[model samples]
Target: MARTGWLRWGSLGVAVLVLVVFLVAQRQSVDVSYGQSPSSSGTVEEGSAGELSDATVPSVEEMSALVKASPVVRLPGSTAYWDEARVNAVIGDAHILVAPPGLDEAERGRVRDVEEAGIRVIGTEVTGGAYQATADTLPDWRAQFATGDVTNLLVTLAAGIAKRPTPPDVDGFRWREPTAAEVEPVAADLRASGLHVAAGATLAKVPDSAKTAFPDGALYVALPRQPYGEPVPNFGPALVKLFPDKPIVVLYGEWIEYHGPREADFASVAAASFYGQAADRISRYAYPQGNVLHAYLNRVTDVRYAGLFDRPLPYVPLDPLRVALPALPWLFAACAAVFLALSATSLRRKAFTTTGTPARLAGLTALAIEVSGLSHDPSVVRGIAKLTAASEALAENLPDQHVRGLLDGASRDLDEVARALGRNDYLSDVYLRGRVA
Candidate 1:
């Protein structure tokens, strides 16, 4: 019996060791430092051709020259979309791409003229009732869309997307999420079109199909927030989780209702790091009016982020930090509970414990909480105050006048920290800094 028991335990230990070794080897097999390469370096899947690999990217140097070409091709979203100067400028400066709200006859003609000039024109579709919303518009759209000048037709989904069926049977349809009731109809249409059916998803609201529906499809992401707004934290992993097997194309619609101050444009660029990894193609809107708008164009198209444009304009990505933020309170709670428990037990009834371990622990933990952007935490402030008291109690043993005075001064600073952070909302350390004096 003793021999059998020893053998059983030994077998279990060997199995556990093997499992750990396998896990480590698997992790080391792939490049895990994804933050360094925001765009994927071409990863292929079993049944599907990836989205990034699907789009033909020209040389980075050529793209850089195109972006630097000035005055760059500029097109307005509204009435002035086809200004003569803008039309003349795009001849060699840029490609003509169809996009958004609606493409008109003259604007389409201008796009065609640019195409005839050897410029590659991309066709875009705005979906969700807009496609088939009117009977007459559909036929006209189909006729214009047939021109080989347009290589791809992207369908931008609206919030009201579910209410409408996606248009079927276009040669170059960038199909995204459609209503559940219309999925079969949409899929049936795509099956007959002999076109690649790719998918488009947004950040906050990803459709179920992105994960399970389109294993072989290319991935297109509509950035969750406006260019100026911060995206969900850890947006990269979130997107990969949703569509693991597809190539990703990021879209930044830097449209402003009323373009604001310089600071707002600056805000748009702050979210660009999210695109650093896994993005195959990035596209932006063609809005020409405000400096802020131009700032957005410059932020993406400039040499710094070269080769990311998906045409019309350049694209930026969303951040991943969004999902990580909500979990921070839990982190604070865990840290607080552990340190507070340790402090209570170790410092019970003592003015100061030996080595001042409990007080130091509390102070460090509280400081960390504040650094994590939770400075307004009332419990953390109270904990710091209690620790300060403990430190003062330790000072009682110091008979040296200078040492005691310094200790007293430190205690005063602790008191001020406690007072400032007693509220609910976060107040910047800068605002509270000199006010204490």
Candidate 2:
């Protein structure tokens, strides 16, 4: 029992040790690099004058000597080689440089230099108006715009601009009245589609149309007229109030302009007014130069209000010790059970036995009787036969003659039984007497 208990405990301990090892092996740590920029282009310090030499700044004579250059320079998004010198050269001869609106500070500086050279910098803010304009004329324009194919529309408009004999007016620009033909088709389409069509002569003209277009609907889209100005002081907020129930989509033909001290404030006001009122419902479409504007709009639109936000922490792998400790009690209990079972089985086997003295003695005496009857070799049957013959001789040597004779007959009968028993024929010879004869 003690041995079995020790063996059981030893097995259980080994099993638990193996389990702990397995669990430890299963533990793993995951490395996560958060907040690191994935760009392989490397980081550029802010406000670095990239690839532009100071000597490249040309004098008036140097600038005047250069031939008349095209106002429109095709500046690819990243690899434009745009320096102050090349920008000045472009500005030197052209009356107006028409590019996309919403230039960064560097670009604005470049534009300012160009404007200082008596050249006008016309930044086109292509808005949803262009989409609507094209949609009115070309039915596929809306679908194309929805799929972000404004490049196709820009190409078409650029082609149109290239073919124009005279440049479009920039200063003191008035909204070009849409022809009756243009307005009529759009109005008819809106009515047919059960959608309201609102026209704005300028940014100020949007409120009335917005109220009439969307009274209780979730969304209100206002398509502004051509040549929209930069977002100014109270204009964006006041326009937002006009559509209290719905978000407004503002579309401008020209890039919105901002200048002086009010630029940041106006941008903030514009963003806040649009976002606070409509949240994500407001979207602006500006022509050529609205990429920055679109980026800003996307930023503001992502703002979400928090009430009771809860999120599960990311799954961190548990330590091997921590995981194994919780299961230790169960493992110990299993080991204990195994030990107990082994101990109980050993104890039961030790307590009971069928090969004790009484059973063995009874079996041996029966074998002697059976051996006396055996006809096999003397050497094989000699021991049991001698014992039986000695018993018979002892009975014959007794002092009482009758008792001695009876004892001798009993011995003879016993010899016959022993002989039968010796021959492995116990069933034929051995019997317990019920009555003495």
Candidate 3:
């Protein structure tokens, strides 16, 4: 029974294993393909355009070069554009491009020329005119891309020089104070143009009136409150709530490089929080444009863009031999056969039984003798002598006729046993003769 149970369980386990293997083989396997397009010199054109040609697309390296050559540009007092150049270098021309609000035909023409040269372009309702008026223009940019005309876009600075003081390390670049009051109107224009608006750390602090105008999906650019410090906590959550459906770009302060691991940690925390909530949304965290930007740009450009990062290939199989092993059905059959063989042998063994009234009586007599100590050869004679004396005493207490008869029978038996044992002087012979009688 135990062997049979073992075999049954083993068979069940093997069957389950076989089923699992079959299911795994039947499931679709994942494969990844990576590719990239060259980026054209100049800006991206906003609005409707056909898919960019593969031939003109620059490799990631080329794009990185362009970003490195350019100066770091930013809205005055805002670190939002700090990493823009660096991000451009990494993503290259693959970014979904948006035109500043109310861009004129001449400016739009210039952007179109850039796209013809093979840079991907996405047009927004926000034109260069609007950007000049107010710095908030990402919402329109996002909406233009969401239209499906451009799947990947990059936010870039306009051609005009900025007015803000430049960092000592950066040359030929200056920051301009962003017209904060103009953000709402620009956000309103973006919303009116059908773009999703979300608020970031910087945007969250905007007046309620501005927040109401843009509502959700507006990308807020924030600078770290302290120089070379970490971003404040809860910044990511605030952005997520504001733009549940759209992506938010976080532009860290000018001193982002000084923050070190703290910046990465914060970014990771923000990424995890936001990605957990909405992976499909296009969320980006970037530091102020600088040497750090160059590093990031180089890293991203070096990647083979053929969706390699987007869709990764399965890893090399470590145990192909194990995967190719024979089916579990055979193993189960072998176990079952072994179990049956053992069971057959056990069943064929001999059986025992006892019968006959004489045999039963003999067994009972042996048990009684053993319990009374008469079976001890050396003590048997003494024990019998003592029994005879006790019987005589019992007879005296009974009626005279009954007592005399019992005593006479016991004395005769005891004398006969003692004479037989004396002649043989053998315990076994005496016991046999006594039992026979």
In model 1, which regions exceed 4 Å deviation? 1-140, 147-396, 399-437
Best by TM-score: 2
Q: lDDT per residue, candidate 2, 63-106, as tens digits?
A: 33331354443322211111233234222333333233334445
Error in Å for residue 214 of model 2: 16
Which candidate should be chosen as best, given lDDT against the real structure? 2
| Candidate 2: C-alpha lDDT | 0.33
Model 3 Cα displacement at 253 (Å)? 21
Candidate 3 global lDDT? 0.32
Which residue runs does candidate 2 get wrong by more than 4 Å? 1-217, 225-236, 239-437
Clashes of 1: 19
Q: How far out, in Å, is residue 275 in model 3? A: 18
